[model samples]
Each structure stands twice: as C-alpha cells, then as structure tokens.
Target: MVDANVMKKTFTVPEIKPLDQYDFNRAKVCASVRWLLAKSYGSAENVPADLREPVLIGQELQAGVSVLLLSPDLYWRAHSQLHLRGVSQGPGQGPGGVSKGPGQGPGGVSQGVVQGGDHVALLQLLASRGHAPRDQDRPVTVEDLQHTPIKTRAHLALIDALMSLAAMETVGRVKMAAEAEQIGGGSPWENALLFWVNRLNQRLRESTEDDDDKTQTCTDLQPAQPAIRYRKDKVQSKLTPTFPLVSGVKDLSNGCAIAAVLHYYCPSRLPLEDVCLKDTMSVADSLYNLQLIRTFCCGTLQGCCPLAVEDLLYAPPTLHMPLGC
Candidate 1:
C-alpha cells in the first residue's frame, strides 16, 4: 500500500493567476478549472495544483469540459442545477430574462445570455454550498473574483466563448475541406491521427507480449482446478484483441481533427453534425471492455456471451477502417 503522506507530497498545486492577467482564451479555460475546483474544494482558490495543471494544457476549455464530463460528481451537480433553474423560470424570463422558447434563441445573442445565466446559476449554487466569498458586499475585482460569485459567472462566460470559437473553427475547416482538393494523404490532421493510432497499437502489442510472458512464468503456480485452467487457456487463445473503433483520440482537438477527417473522407460515418468524437471513443472503449469481460465471465461459467439483438441483425464489423485508405 502507498503512504498517504507520500501521495500528498507528490501532489503539487499550480498557481491560479488573477483572471484578468490571462488573455480571453486562457481565462476561459481557467474559469472551467475554477468551477471544477470550487465544486470539489468548496473554493476555487483551494483547488490543488496537480488537478489544475492538466486542464491548463492544450485546448484548456475542452480539457476542462472533459474533466467535468468524466467526473459524475461535478457533471450531475451542475447539470441538475441548470435543469432545475430552466424548469423553474417563467416563460418570459428565459435565460437572462430574454423571452425565447427551447431551441429558439437569436443565434449568438441568446447563446451568450444562456451561458451567462449558467455561470451565475453555478456560482449561486456553489455559494449556497459555502464556496463563495464571505465578503459578498465588497466591490469585486480580478483577485476577488476567485472566491466570489462574479468570478464564477465570468468563468462560465469564458467557457461559452471558448466553445463558440471551437464550433466556428470546425465549421471553417469543413468549408475549406469542401472547396480544397482532398487534403492530400499527407495532411497534418491525418499524420497526427496516424501517429497516435500507431503509438496506441504498438503499446497494445507490447503489453500483450508482456502478458504472455508473465502467464508462462506463472504456469507453475496455476490453480489445481482443471476446468478453470482450461477455460482460462481457451479464452486467452480464442480472444482476438483488436483496437476499439474510437480508442485513439485523447483530446478535443485531436477528436475534432478525426471528425473532420471522417467528414472529409467518409461523410456517412458521421451521424451528427456536432458529434463529440471523444465521447464516442469513450463509449466505444467502455463497450469493448465490457464485452471482453462478459465473454471471459460467461466462458468461465461454461456459457456463451450473448450478443445484443441489434448486433446480431448486422454482420460483424471490422474494428475500424484502414488508416492508409
């Protein structure tokens, strides 16, 4: 077991600079971090550096969003509150007191208002949970923003701005792709995707080889149950481990790049315009592991893993399309 003190010692908190000091782009990212820290730590100022550093890296806004998405505690809390507020508000008081039905916002204007409302609601919720500054009556400044509701609101707005920018960038790329020659096979997006995919596959292969070596070394210590041993050996031999369809892209930019590539080369593959490739990858990875576990468990019980009815309706598909094509 690891020592708690050693673990604590290993953790370092990154410096949370004044929000004003960060240009608009960075401040937006920091805002998401602040919101997360505020949820977990009660005060954004109290957020540990170790947790803050990763979100601060490339595509901070997306990183921050990913953090929230992965953490049920944070995601549900914010989402629940947002949902409650949306339902409680009167018809005329639609996000920011601007009257608009669901999906009827004035393009960009209502988006900004809705985001502003979300930030305020989040900060208010945090404040109720004792995360807000005690000196609520005091004049708000950049430093004060860290522990104040205003800071939370600003951070929320920043998050919205960052998302809008990302959407615009994606649209611009799609438009460019339509007008330009097929991004030659050597485009940067394709190269990056290829690099990450190859790296993942290579690592997987290495890990499998290591596992096989370990299994051989541990053969002498095998359990006395012949049935168990046979099942384990059979499962190991029969399992054809292939990379899951959506396992390669790790970050938002890479996910978007992959999506763009898909849209450019095989448009039918994308079912949604605003498809979150990262989320899809996450789901695919989960399903792949679950299927493997189910197969192993059922095999041990002398039963077969049952495929879903939908899966049986179609022919078994390849893990993914060839990268070279």
Candidate 2:
C-alpha cells in the first residue's frame, strides 16, 4: 500500500519566496548552457576523464556525444518526482484504485536503465553538495536547499552521459546492419551496442506492461471519487477525483514525472521510431512554466554549481527561449 502521509507531504507545492529564493533565474541557466557547449566544442573537459577513454575508443562513434550525457540527469529529475509523488486518481492512477506504491512495485522502476543511472548520480552529487543529509545533518529541510544555485557542472556531465549512451546505442544498432557487399565483415561495436539496446528496449516495454497492470487493478478495485475543486478557468480549475490530502502541486508534478519516465524509456529515434519530439517539448515547457515546478527545479539546483533550472528550460530545439533573457 502507498503511504498517504508521504504523498501529502511531498506532493504539495513547496512554499518559497519568488526570485529571491532561486539564485540563477532564466538568464543564468542560459549562460551555463553556452559554457557547456563551449566545453564540448573545445574538448576542454566536457567529457569526464573516467568516461573519455571508453567513449573515444568505442566501436560506434557519434559526432555530438553530449546529448547522450544530458539524458540521465533529465530523466533522473523526472523519475524522482514520479517516485516521490504517487498518482492520486484520474489518468495516472494505479491498479487497486489505491495510491501508487512509493518504492519498487507494480508502477515503480518504469523509468529506463539510463534514467536509473541518473537517479544514482543525482544522489551522489546532492550528497557532495550538502543537500543530502550526513550523519551530523540528520534532518532534511527546504531551508537547507534555499541558498544553493540550481546550475551545476554535474548536471551538464549527466546530460552528456545520457546523450552519449543514446548515441552509442543508435550507432551500434546502425553498424549491425550488413550491406550486400559488407555482409562478411561483422562490426564488433555494432554487435555490442545492439546487445544493450535490445535489452533496454525489452526492459522498458515490460515496465510499461507492469504499469498497465497496476492501472487496471486500481480501477477495478476502487470506486471513483468526486471532484474537489471546480472553476470556470481552464487552467486553475480542478477536473475530477478530489483526493483531499494530495495537493495540485503534487498531482501535476506526478503526471509530469510519469510523462518524463515514458519519454526517457521510450524516446523515438530519428529516422527510426517516430517519438513526437514536439509533444515532449510541450510537456517540458508547461512543467517549467508552472510556478511550483519552477520552484522544484530551483530546489534541485541547490548547492550545484554552474548549472541552473534555466539551462534545462531554454535549451534550443526544446523551448528556444532567448538566452539573454
């Protein structure tokens, strides 16, 4: 069974002062992006020392590898929200019509392997930042995160890792196909990449199935509830399924987080699968624009250096929000 208290506590919009709370606003995030791009182009420490040798010597090489690296962090933030905030009701509800489980259960681990890596990385980074509790720092609080900057190099490193992983998979898969003339010469890198890609795809598909089963169980077992808040405004007004404890902040973030998991696990490869980038972009935009989500992003940025919520929000081909702003 899901913990109602945890959901009630985490799902609500964390109270925060407006611009004062977040160190890096929209502009600072943008600048950090340029810095990342410069590092990537210059080959000036963009790729982690630990990962560089493997990446350079890999079987399938990608022209722009940073994209893969970024994915893990993005998915981590998204998955963390999903993990923390279980769906209350409506479209994202679980099987027994009860709240979704917190840890690994029917609806858990839906995020992909790469995303899992990001979750681990995020915790390590947070621990280094002091946001993560130590033996001395027993309790965790928003105040602990208040002064920290959202932007950090670690986030950029994470993005690069995700982009690299995806690229490695794509290139590996591409190399596996034998042309009429080159049928005899097998590419080793291609085979290796295919091995992992196939595994990832299968795992993600199964996770989706698990989610479906949970959803079915919830709907079948529980009776539907009444709407809590209704208003004329399209944006502010509540639609249905008024669970008293769960706040709007928690509800929306949970939806966005689930959507993020779906996105990371099921990214549509260009010239391969037609995963709608536009749709994903729209979701990212809407989530960042929300005051609550922006605050959460800012919170995640706490103690991190050189990376900010703005960087994620304004990435080109994503939002295309102006850099100077």
Candidate 3:
C-alpha cells in the first residue's frame, strides 16, 4: 500500500511562481552526467572520466545542490545504518566461524569471500527481530541469518559501515535536539533524516566557531527555553533555520549526501564522493531481497515541487523539476 502522505504530494499544486536563475548551465551539466552515470552502472563511480566536468556544471545550474547518484550498496552504507547490525552466525556459534548449514566444507567451516547471501541472511534476521519485513514474498527468519558465514573483509566493511552510521546519527541528534520542538511527530524517517541534521548542524557549528559572540549564541541556544529566548534577543535566528522535519524525505536524503557536496567544495581536495563499494550490484541488490530490508537513498525527490514523492528508482535521470521535486 502506498503511504497516504506520499500519495497526497503527487497531486500538490505549487503556489510559488518559478523564477529565472543566472543560467544553471553548470548545475544542469553536473546533474545530467551524475544521473546518467548512476543509471548506467547503478553507481556514480562508474561515471566516465571525460564527462565529469559537464556533470559539475549541471550541479551549479541546479543551485549549489548536486543530485548525487550512488550505487545502491554504497547508498545503503552511507544513508542507512542497516550494516551496523552484525551478521548473525547462528545460535551458540563462536566468533571464529563455523558453518551452520549447507555449503559446509572440510572441518564443518565455511571459507573464502563473504557472499551476498550472508548479507541477506543478516537482514532477514534483523527484520524478523524488528518484525518490519519489507517483502511478503520471501519469508525469512533470524535463524537463517545466524547461519551465514561472512569473510573478514565483509566483516570489517560492516564495522566501518556501522561506525559511519553512528557518526551520522550522533551528529544528527545534536542538530535535532537544538530544534526538537520544531520537528513534528513520527520518528525521523528511519533512513536519512538524522544524517542531514548532523551535516547541517556541523556546517552551522563550523560557520560560527570563529565568532565568539556567535559561538556563545549557539551554545546558549542549546537548551530549549534559552534557545527560544536567544531567538528573540539575538537578531539572526535564521542563519541556518532549523530544518523543519516535514512530512517528506527530501531534506533527509539531501543531508546524507552533503558530505559528497563538501568533497567538491575546493578543487585541491580529493573527491571521495565517487568511491564505490567493492561489490556494488550483488551486495546492494541483496538488501532488497526478503532476507534484507536495507533502504538505499538515491534519486529520492523531496521539496516544494509537485512531484515530491517520485523517488529516484521510479523516475528518469534528468528533469526540469527541482532536484527533489
């Protein structure tokens, strides 16, 4: 069933008239290339070396915001904290590793690379525990996850994924707490909301750190009541207006990708934005399998536009509408 809120947005008629820009030639170019690359290989890292400039140009045209297309697997790692939950290796199983089911070889152990099956098993296990399985077609259980054996590299990758997720959450909460009242009901969309909050808060902090008065104001704004008063007493409460958690997903998704934007801030800096998961398709697609419920954030459109709910997976690469529109 479609989310009712998501449904309503599809019919929304925008109130504000469109305004002209200085020529988003740069932004358009970047967005187009980013979209093409993401769609072609289901990852931006696969973007050809030659077209990178045009893509950056497109991003400039679209405003400073660049529509980043990520490999579904990398998308999960960055935006969804699903990888944090370690792969279950069965009941009473030790950390060293032992095969619990089929495919066991000599010494009743599994060896070699950790395949996508192992990841899916972990997802299934989590879903059963949470009772939030996305797929009705493939029924799986925690028992299955407990039996999958993953290689050391996959294990380490999972750990790194978890750390990244935690960092995003820790930072996001810091930002959210500052404007808790402004955030409406419901848990922040379980995927990317927290990540955005973290990035915006980081930017706000970095921007104001050098200014003593600004620093004091930000610190003073920490407590809710004091923050309210500070808002009245201080002239600039809107510097980075607390991002209102609306009944949509664009803000959260954009926030998660801010790190990517930061990568492009200066030419001298290395671009880590194009980094891809070692195994992109198989690993990422497995998340959608009944065993794993990991949600990837890409092409997630959200904003004041009419088709805000039209997610990246569903729409075309380039559009005249706003990035999240």
Candidate 4:
C-alpha cells in the first residue's frame, strides 16, 4: 500500500501535499540542507543545483551508521549492568596485545582501526537488517547522491531505506522505549525492550543507578489521560489503545514525549515555549515535534545519529538490533 504521508513532515504544520513523484522537491531539500549548514560554524554554504558538497553528506551518513551500531549495545550493557562480553579465557593475552614483529619493534596495539567505508558500511548494515537493495536497481554512487539527483521511484525507495534505519538511537530514548520490546527483547520478537529501557533509564539517572522508570517503560502500560491520545485521529482519538494497556509505541508517537525528555537534558535545543505537551492529532504538529526531537539528537546529544524528517514520520516497526553488534 502506498503511504500518502510521504514528504509531509516539516517544521511547520504539515499540509499533506500531493506528490508528483517520489523524490523530495528540490526546493525543500535545498532549504533543509541550507538550514543544517547555517547552524554550523562559519558562513552557511548555499547548496547549488548540484548538491556537490560530498564530504559533509558522507561524514554524516558514516556518523549515522556508527550511532545505530553502538546505541543498542550500549542500551544492552546499561541494562545488564555488567560486562556481558567478559572472556571465558580471562584477560589471558589481555584485551589488546601489541603485535611484536621479528625484524622491528612492537606494532603498538592497533588503536581505533575501524574498517569499511561509510558507503559500504551503510549498505551492509541495511542488507544485514533485511532491507537489502534490489538487484534491478542501479548503485547510488557519491556522484548520484551528490551530483546526480535521482529521477525515478529510486528516491522514494532510498527514503524508505533511511526511514527503515532512523527510528531509534538519535531522536531520543522515547523511540527506543517505544520499540523497547524488540531491541533487548529476545529473537523472533519478544522483553528485550523493557530490559533495555530499565537499563537506559537507570543509566540516565543522577547516579549510575538502576533503571526504575517502570510506569514509563514499555512493559507496563499507562492509563487514559488527556495528556496522551491512543492514536492520531479525530473521531476515535480519545479511545484507549489496547484498552487495558498502551505501550510507549502509541503513547509517544506524536513526539511530545520526546520533547519532554529533551527539555530535561538539553533545554537550549527545545525552548519551553516550543514544547506542547497536550496530545495533538495534527500531522504537522506531530512532525514538528519530531523535528524538534531530531534537532536535539543531531546537535546536543553526543554520538547521536541524524535522521531525515521522512524517517521520523515513517519509522519502521522495531526489530532485533543485531546482537552480533
């Protein structure tokens, strides 16, 4: 089924514009990129018709991949509160033994030797997660992403790929909380989420304390309150999701919960005047809330990944976040 909500998320109220095709309108793309650049130090570099600035885009993609790779593991470790990767062989040779060469001196323990290019790493990440690109599709090179704007349904597919990846890690713990059941939850779908949540919330506490935010965790459900609506609808908006229970997935979907979380940690990123705690059924309002959340993630949070507005709007259902991480 075609989702009509594509390209709708914006800082302002979403207008539900009809798409001529799948790609983002150049005007919108240019505007957002320019805004991203403007925030950086030095004069904002205007993105010309040729989106020729490859370095930043490449770096950003690499950064996003790294964030995705690391956060789930961090969540897990925080939940466990112990070094789960402890070697059965003990410290034996120790963690990193410098390679001693016969002819020369020690090859001083190889520090920070991260392999794989960002392009390959991103594709591999997607492939590993079952979001592999199609064989019929042409490969997207730096040239294609930077110099040549896509001209078919490719852009839409690409956006789907990104949206598939961006839901968790960067935006806030809220998205992770929503999908908590999937990440730390066991294989084939099951509590890893709550386990992770308890850990993360604890890690976030004043001290390196325990994750005790049960009411807010996904495992436990909250009640029908005017503060949160089950769904973004007009007629049935007030209805309680799952009646007896509602996880963070539905309760925090509008992005308001994320805003509240950000305000506590990074007040400067989201001003109090900008935050609206009340439940909002408007698509634009929801996207704006997510925009604010994404802004905080990409800017204030350390090691936080970046995601497109489309990604925030169309986040995929949570899945196992690769235990082999």
The candidate maximizing TM-score is: 4
Sort the predicted structures by lDDT, highest score first.
4, 1, 2, 3
Candidate 2 deviant stretches above 4 angstroms: 1-30, 33-208, 214-285, 288-297, 301-314, 317-325
Ten residues in sequence with the least summed lDDT for candidate 2: 269-278
**lDDT tens digits, residue span 1-325, model 4:** 0011322332344433343432333323322233322221112332232332322332232233223223222111111111112312222221112222233221111222211123444445456555544424765432333232232233223333433333222222344444545444233122433334344434333221221232244543554332222223222333221111113333344555445545546655665335443323456556666666666655665313223454344432321121101
lDDT accuracy of residue 45 in candidate 1: 38
Q: Write candidate 2's Cα lDDT for 3-83 as tens digits.
A: 122223433423333444433333333333433433332222433444333223322222233343334433343323322
lDDT score of model 3?
A: 0.30
lDDT of 4: 0.34
TM-score per prediction, in order, is 0.21, 0.21, 0.28, 0.35
List the lowest-lDDT window of 10 residues for candidate 4. 74-83
Give me the runs in candidate 4 sitting further than 4 Å from their true place: 1-252, 267-273, 318-325
Which of the two candidates, 2 or 4, achieves a greater TM-score against the reference? 4
> Worst 10-residue stretch by lDDT in candidate 1?
315-324
- Quote the positional error of residue 207 for candidate 3 in Å: 3.3
Pitting candidate 1 against candidate 4, the one with the higher lDDT is: 4
lDDT for each residue of candidate 3 in 79-176, tens digit (9 for 90 to 100): 22222334344643322122334564321233421213344533443344443222234443333223233122222223223333333344344445
lDDT, each prediction: 0.33, 0.31, 0.30, 0.34
Clashes of 2: 26
Which TM-score value belongs to model 2?
0.21
Highest-scoring model, lDDT? 4
